[model samples]
Target: MRFSMHSTLFDPDALPFRRALIAGIACVAAVVAGAMLADQPYLIFAGLAGLVYVGTLTVNCRALAWLVIALQPAALIVPFFPGRPFWWELCALLAWPSLLAYGLVNRRKIEVVAFDRAERWALAALGGYVAVILGTMAYRGVGLRIFGGEQMGGRVYVQQLVLSILPVLMLLAGFSQKQLRMAMITGWLLSLTYIVSELTFARSQDMAPLLYFFELPVDGLNFSTGYDASGVRRFGSLAAVAGAGLSLLWVAAPLRELLGRWLLVTGPLMVALVGLGLGSGYRNVFASAICTLFFLAWVQRFWNPSRVISMVLVGAVMVGGLYFFAKELPLSVQRSVSFFPGIAISPIAKADAATTNSDRVEVLKLAIADSPKYWLFGRGFGMDRFDRLPVDDPNDSVSMLYSQGMFYNGFLGTLLKLGVFGLLCSLLFVWHVSKIALQLGLLVRRRTPSEWSFFDRVCLLLCAQWFAAVLLFYLTNGDVTWWMQSFGLLAGLLMACRRLKQDEGFVVDSDGVPKASVTA
Candidate 1:
């Protein structure tokens, strides 16, 4: 046999490949049985989901896995208009059965990567938190109703657990270093696309229709030309802004030296897109993005003596330029910056900003007030706003009014729902992941520029972004576990990569092929 480097990348005869194939076949058999017996039309959706996931697992293509992961943000952000199912949930939900089947069949092929001390502690904390939630639910009874209002049985509890755990398990079992790199690239590209689309369509008369078609929020319609009713267009709302900010951190990090020279041209374009996207009304997103950049720079040692002068000059120019041109800047952009700690703006704008800021403060206050009542276990996990809202409500305004309640300050909500103990565990989990990301960043920074491969560098950046994304999301939006789970999956894969040392273990290369050095 020839010793072509690429040849080992896709060895179908490999045990993992064969095991994945067998599991897929079993899934197909089940789908066929379901169709024959149940005769439900939705079985087709299930079949499609199963087949695609089976193919991805068996093929072990890093590109395919990343394509799916990259689309996750869009799936979450994109609207699920009237009569449409939230495809993001559907996509995530349908993927689990096939992945579990593959995992069981390939159980022996699965390498149980040992968690380091910090990771072990993190996992233990998370497990304990979940146990507390479940215990409290069991004792008080689980329900769609808050606290002791109504006991709806264990259906919601079980569903929340499944939803939360499925993605984490999939990432742990399915992803590799190569997929992580591709996910970073895809995430960046998608974020760029989102900003470009938002900017390009901001002034269009048909903006609402276009956004509706894509299931994006139309942002209000009462504002000025090109502005949403809130006087800003939050293309993907805070999520989109947060995603872009994370992407920007990657673009600005000291890691740029490791990326290809081509990024020199592409890099500025990305920065511009992101900068323009963080307009007025996106204070939280903007703050998160700025804080993350500072964090990345500090960790990467962006303040080395050699670069101090350049850093100061650049900072001066950015602040000065914006200050000088503040009036001429896009209203949205100006409004975005107006709420910064010491920015000055018109009295009306200032009042508007004050009102907006107070909403969050009030929500936090409300959460704090409610926390003491159920401080031990917190409100039950996965309390959906839709479940609380009447399905028969004729008031079109009800959805808008209650939707915000769905995610009210996610960080505070977590504290209120899970109690201080659960919140501490959640923070511990985040700390562990952040520690790993910081380690990766420091390692990458110390690497001789030429020694760092495309795969390694991108993986590091993505892990960092994933860490930042979760932190920003947790502190602000706090919703379902999907986004957090995505980051956790990234963290898990990054940890695996670190421990396995791709060149040593039975690891696949950047091309998704098994390395020749890895023997059975």
Candidate 2:
């Protein structure tokens, strides 16, 4: 039986609540006393408070969603220093308890689906990997020596367990379609915040102190104005820049009633998109965002043919503009814009854009070569780097000079840690997410005029962008386990929201509220 928060039996203010409150107080007292006796009561109260805060917030999924959205960027920056607990892991720990309590109170059951099964399978594979690591540590009887020791192994083991499993569980436990939109809107707001912060940092001399005062990462902040060795001024990390472009792309494609058709078709919206891409020096991110926009336009072609045509025309113009004005553009912009010169149908041409692709290919080859030796189960986590005998050859130069680690590649890293079986499980998880996203995308496409279509479309766009980011990161940034963990969380939440939408059998109205009747 579902119990509302207002019900006398469930409400904290009611008579029965006093007994429950007394028990809770006793438990808290017992915990505190035990901690004190153990001589480890430090920060216990603070930890308890944090738990209470998260528990309270998660009872409302909307609040939880917003919290998740806000935490995304913070998670990347806050945990920069070593020996610090990850913010998202803490979020997961607190969220699970509250999620369980809410589920018990409301008598909610987990709905089983194909994707959920895939998620479980993935979890099991990860569990097996952990088990192997632990078992090896035990069997070898390794000690606490830090370097290449069991202590380091244990830490790596624990870190992976928490990051890999907790986020997925937290999202799967609680999320709805409304919450999904809330996350997307929050993401957009964050993008705008990034833009504002970058502009401020560039324009103001004293902004560094202000940014530091707000606990933001000052050194890593990129305003897309500084040039690299190649004279390219990349906006930010691949994910950050791609995410910013995604925000602009979502709104750029459709301004339905807010602006005229011509504006949506050929004017300011398109200009903003190009500006965003040019500003972000990341070629992969720009291409990914543009591809996502094109995909969306293609999907909505039946509903909005003019938008599609406009996008095609925009691409042609972009190519031509790059060809004619290649050198006229800023050096940073020219570095990216010059890629179109070869196919621009003009005499003007420039060398193909510079890249680290060769370095990445070398790393991938190394990963491929090492995969077979550890084919069944991997050497264990945190042991991705190795020594190669032929390292002295000047012709065989690679980024990893002293000790070779997989550089700018994650698939190899995954294979190095979890082996072929684990790799399959991870791939299954991706397959499941892709399937659900496509289904949801098709649903939104068919239900043309539905009120929530815009939000759904954005979610679809985000999913595509996410997939692109994954590919980009795998190829160009090996230390993307952070990204993968977060992706797992996002995919789980998205799937959960899709499940809720399917079960509810209704459509959102113009006011952005779900209506009882389903849209045709």
lDDT of each candidate versus the true structure = 0.53, 0.51
As a whole number from 0 to 100, the lDDT of residue 63 in candidate 1 is 35
Model 1's C-alpha root-mean-square deviation from the true structure amounts to 10.3
Estimated TM-score per prediction? 0.67, 0.67
TM match of model 2 to true structure: 0.67
Distance from true position, residue 105, model 2, in Å? 6.2
Clashing pairs in 1: 9-513, 79-215, 220-229, 280-332, 280-336, 410-478
Number of clashes recorded per candidate: 6, 0
* Model 1 stretches with alpha carbons more than 4 Å out: 1-68, 76-88, 133-163, 166-177, 192-213, 217-234, 237-271, 346-348, 381-411, 442-446, 466-486, 496-520
Global fold similarity of model 1 (TM-score): 0.67
